[model samples]
Target: MHESLFSYINQNAASPLTSDEEALIMASFQPKKYRKKQYFLQEGDVCKYVGFIVKGAMRQYSVDDKGAEHIVNLFLENWWVSDRESAVMLTPSRYNIDTWEDTELLVATVADMVDLIGKIPLFGQMTRLMDQRSFIASQRRLNSTISNTADKRYEEFADNHPKFIQRFPQHIIASYLGITKDTLSRVRKQAMKK
Candidate 1:
């Protein structure tokens, strides 16, 4: 479980972490399991844990005033998911995070993470890079949503998250892309013909 998570972090982090540091990170980590459709973070609740995915997929979303769901993200194996702002701020969350399937997560509390980061310099650098990537990706997604056609949005989304095309349900994927299921189907059909 730790292997895949650490491998992903090490590969993606700006500075590589040593084996000793990795071992230290594993020391304070706790494992948790979620049943299919279980909530990790719920709207109006505080998000206290940051998780590394060991198995299965999770979706981060929120319900609108009209009760339509908007998916913010899909996390799979080796992915990290949490209400970063809420967890860091210790405030109520506006988003909801839940399992798409039975999922196993390696959880580290914010306090534990703070301690680990202060002790491990590599961890801080790594987290900074990851946060930067997250910010950039969010901006790009926003741009895509506002400026591009639905088909273009789906096409680029498929290009970036190749695995999600197969991993997520079509309706869920369409929700994430801010389009109807029929639009997603047409976009996919058009994409395949290209």
Candidate 2:
């Protein structure tokens, strides 16, 4: 069950971890499962765990004042999903994280993370890299939303996450790209012609 997690850790680590270190890391995580549409974190609740997706898909989103949902990102296999600020600060999260499909996750609490970092120093480095990469990705997404045309945004999102285009429904993809469903359909048709 932890095979995917172990491989992901080893592949992303600066150097190979010893068997004992791998065991220690694995021991720190606990498994959880969510059925489709089940929530891992909800708005106004403190996010207590950082989850690594073992299978299926999850989405991070927020409801606006008008009661509409805006998708922030989709979390897929081998990805980490969390309201980072809330998880780290023990504050209530503004976002809700829920499964798009039945999902298996290996999750760690902040205390568990702290213990792992203290015991396995290399994990600290790996986490730093993870944070940096997450920040860069967030920046790119924000830039795309602000500066690109809807069609351009859809195209970039499709190119960057082709797997998501295939995995998620059109409406979900439209929300993630901050476009209307009609606009997404139009964009897809236009792309096909080009």
Candidate 3:
């Protein structure tokens, strides 16, 4: 499980971690598991931990006043999960995070993350890279939602994230793409013909 994190760090960091740095990380992060449908975070609860997925899937979403769920993000193995604002600002999360499958995670408290960032240069660099990628992806997704037609959005999503198409249900993918499930089905059928 730790090896998965080590590999992610090695792939993303400017430099590989040293033995002592790995030890520091091991001490800071603890392994946790969630069964399918279990909640990692609930709406209005403060998020206390950041989790790196070792295996399985999760989704971050919000429920509207009408009780409809709007998925903000879907995560798979090697992805990091947290309500950043809730964790950083010590505020309640507006979104709920839950496991889509039986999941394994390595989780760390905010303080532990801060300590690791201060102590390990490579770890800090990796986190900054992750943050930048996250921001860029979010901006792109928002732009697509605003500017692209449903068909175009579905095409782009399929081209870029084929794994999501395979792993997630059509309804979940539709929610993420800001389209109705019927629209997604039509788009997919049209795409298949093309």
TM, every model: 0.93, 0.95, 0.98
lDDT of 3 by residue, 110-142 (tens): 899999999999999999999999999999999
Report the poorest 10 consecutive residues by lDDT, candidate 1.
8-17
> Between candidates 2 and 3, which one is better according to lDDT?
3
Q: For model 2, how does the per-residue alpha-carbon lDDT over 1-194 read when each residue is reduced to its tens digit?
A: 67888787778787877889878877888889899999999999998788899999999999999998999889899999889889888889999999999999999887888888888877887788888998998899999999999989988888889999889999999999989999999999999999
Local accuracy by lDDT, each model: 0.88, 0.89, 0.95
lDDT, candidate 3, equals 0.95
lDDT of 1 by residue, 86-186 (tens): 98888999999999989999999888888887988877777787889899999999999999999889889888999898889999999999999999999
Task: For candidate 3, report its TM-score.
Answer: 0.98
* Candidate 3 ranges beyond 4 A from true positions: none
lDDT of 2: 0.89
Candidate 2 contains a number of clashing pairs equal to: 0
Clashing pairs in 3: none
Pairwise TM-score winner, candidates 1 and 3: 3
List residue ranges in candidate 1 displaced over 4 A.
13-20
Alpha-carbon deviation at 175 in model 2, angstroms: 1.2
Query: Against the true structure, whose TM-score is highest?
Result: 3
